[model samples]
Target: VEVSGLPPNLNRSCCDCGVYALKYIESHMLNLPLDLINEDNIREARLKLAVDLWAASKDPVLIDRMEKYEPHNNSSDIVDVS
Candidate 1:
């Protein structure tokens, strides 16, 4: 697996496609039972994705933002601040 290639010290690698796959998975996870996506679930999924992105970037700002993620009640797309 591609994840097995990176050294322990360099755990972050920009696998662009992998990132997209994560996005897709997040979307799927957020989809609702009535075929109407739940905004809260989507917001949670987005936060998780942002955390993953922050880990891959090794950027302090992103990392800090990851911890401060707030789930908004309005819309799922709005929570995707990453």
Candidate 2:
């Protein structure tokens, strides 16, 4: 969504859209079989989604913003990617 590229204060719509999608997916998962919802499968799915999303964006500012997001827990992981 273009809202993802908006300033943080203006990004609520995009963030809520993502949250809604996740809630919908979770509801689907709950009704699905246990044999298909493994941790490895979820992780792989997340990675693939992230890669595909990154590939779809052409904005340098958004790219730079994404580089600043740290997946690990630590202050040193912080980066001024912008």
Candidate 3:
């Protein structure tokens, strides 16, 4: 499938970037002819890939900003219906 025109702010926030990462893997990487991920190696591979990406970006400020976000507190004023 041809995926295009992702949201402009897809990488603006940590959550959005995470979603984008998952989408990217699903759309592109998963189709590659490799069986590197399975029940036994998935966890290790996931952590390794995340660390590698973080190192490649070399943007600790963005990581700190993402860590500081508190969506739950931001929406605390709203009443929950369920």
Point to the candidate with the largest lDDT: 3
lDDT of all predictions:
0.51, 0.52, 0.55
User: What does candidate 3's lDDT look like per residue over 1-82, in tens digits?
Assistant: 7654444533433434443455457646557422332345445555776797878677888778888977764554768799
| Candidate 2 segments whose C-alpha is farther than 4 A from its true place | 1-35, 59-82
For TM-score, the strongest prediction is 2
TM-score head-to-head 1 vs 2, winner? 2
Positional deviation of 32 in candidate 1, in angstroms? 11
**Runs in model 3 with CA error above 4 Å?**
1-36, 59-82
Alpha-carbon error at 47 in model 1, in Å?
Answer: 0.8
Candidate 3, residue 21: Cα displacement in angstroms equals 11
Model 2 clashing-pair count: 0
Off by over 4 Å in 1: 1-37, 59-82
Task: Please report how far candidate 2 places residue 51 from its true position, in Å.
Answer: 1.0
**lDDT by residue (tens digit), candidate 2, 1-82:** 1112222342233434453345346646576433353333555555666787777697788889888988876577668889
Considering summed lDDT, which 10 consecutive residues are worst modelled in model 1?
1-10
What overall lDDT, based on C-alpha atoms, would model 2 receive against the true structure?
Answer: 0.52
Clash count, predicted structure 1: 0
